[model samples]
Target: MSATFTEVLPARKSSKHSAIQWRPVTDDTHVAGVLTIHTDRASVAYTVSEFPTDWPGRGFLLAKETAGTDPESERYSVFCAAAGPWGDTCDCKGFTYKATCKHVDAVRALVGNAWL
Candidate 1:
């Protein structure tokens, strides 16, 4: 008789950015959703707090650039991936439109591309 033994349990999946020390935004700011996730996180408040965690364990400040007049205008909203509906998101217009932006890229580069 031929019999096949199935594994007792499936392998455990780990987050790539688990090393990142993410925090909650704790603000009323709203971010458009790009990714739809249903999985539950250990901390609902920190569900989006996944990414680079090697930063100096301190408070982070996001600077939102407002549009300028006169001749040139540079307007951009700094993305805060620390907290979001789906997590790993930015607040930039590009990210809102394409779900990706230079700010996000820069963070990925700074953190060695460890985003979930």
Candidate 2:
């Protein structure tokens, strides 16, 4: 006996914009892999991976006052610090005043490969 799976593709025309669809080619075989999709808003979607389940979604904000090489660059410094303890809530020192500060937005922009 084998297992099978199917994934529907999104409706985008551009090769860069088109969604990916995955399915098992065999009836008696099992396949496991990871799928990641990036969009205009820097959206990240992952499948069958420890990276997704372990870390999940997170945002970062760069410290404007601090001076250095700007580890995350200027565009993605929106979320330089953890919102809360382990990012549970947006209560970090960087977000004391504003709820959705520039740092948070920058963090959202730097998800996935951008972090690496």
Candidate 3:
């Protein structure tokens, strides 16, 4: 599936002759379900939310770029898992896990056009 951008802005030039670059600080795997990015004048903090049935929530500050343009622009995109696992638990009595599973993956592919 194509990536979606929530915000877009023009790039800013730092020095009159120097070029600015827009770099992505997060990867698809890191921000699969991230809901927000908090930023200070110098840096940004990524806020990731977990499925209620999974592990604890997670957050991180981006230290480098993963992808994007040069001469940093204000435009930004958010990536979402197009598909995920779901359905009744498996019959295996010894297994116990929550959150989207392989079943959800199949459903997501049929519905969202891609898997997360």
Candidate 4:
């Protein structure tokens, strides 16, 4: 049940990073997936937006990095659960803050590795 959702993939990204599986939480508004990103440097925090009440739809700007960087920046993107395909439009504050965010990047890497 929960264990399956929390399963982590093998390490990637220069042998310093790995993406753990997503954990599902039930909400009256939207279902959510929380993924943990592990790096040799530090632990990364991530969040996903509310999944729609309907099926077969994409969740966009739902993913975000909650912490694990200087001043605790944020990042956002999209992920496919049982809904449909995986896609993302990064809205991380880093662009405006003039910094790089690994949250969206991590999600992109995980999905690219077929972890979705």
The most accurate candidate by lDDT is 4
Per-residue lDDT over 31-51 for candidate 4, one digit per residue giving the tens place of the 0 to 100 score: 345666665666655555543
lDDT of 1 by residue, 38-76 (tens): 112221111232223443321222332222121141333
Model 3: lDDT to the true structure: 0.26
lDDT values, one for every candidate? 0.31, 0.30, 0.26, 0.48
lDDT of 1 at 45: 12
Score every model by TM-score: 0.28, 0.24, 0.18, 0.48
* Ten contiguous residues minimizing lDDT sum, candidate 2: 45-54
Q: Per-residue CA lDDT of candidate 3, range 1-116, in tens? A: 33432322222232122211222325554544322221122322223322223322211222223322222533222222323232323211111343322222222322243212
Count clashing residue pairs per candidate: 4, 15, 14, 1
Global local distance difference test of model 4: 0.48
lDDT, model 1, position 62: 31
Comparing 3 with 4 on TM-score, the higher-scoring candidate is 4
- Model 1, CA-based lDDT: 0.31
**Model 4 regions more than 4 Å off:** 4-15, 50-59, 62-66, 78-88, 93-101, 105-116
| Candidate 2 vs 4: which has more TM-score | 4
RMSD (Cα, Å) of model 1: 18.4
Report residue 24 deviation for candidate 2 (angstroms): 36
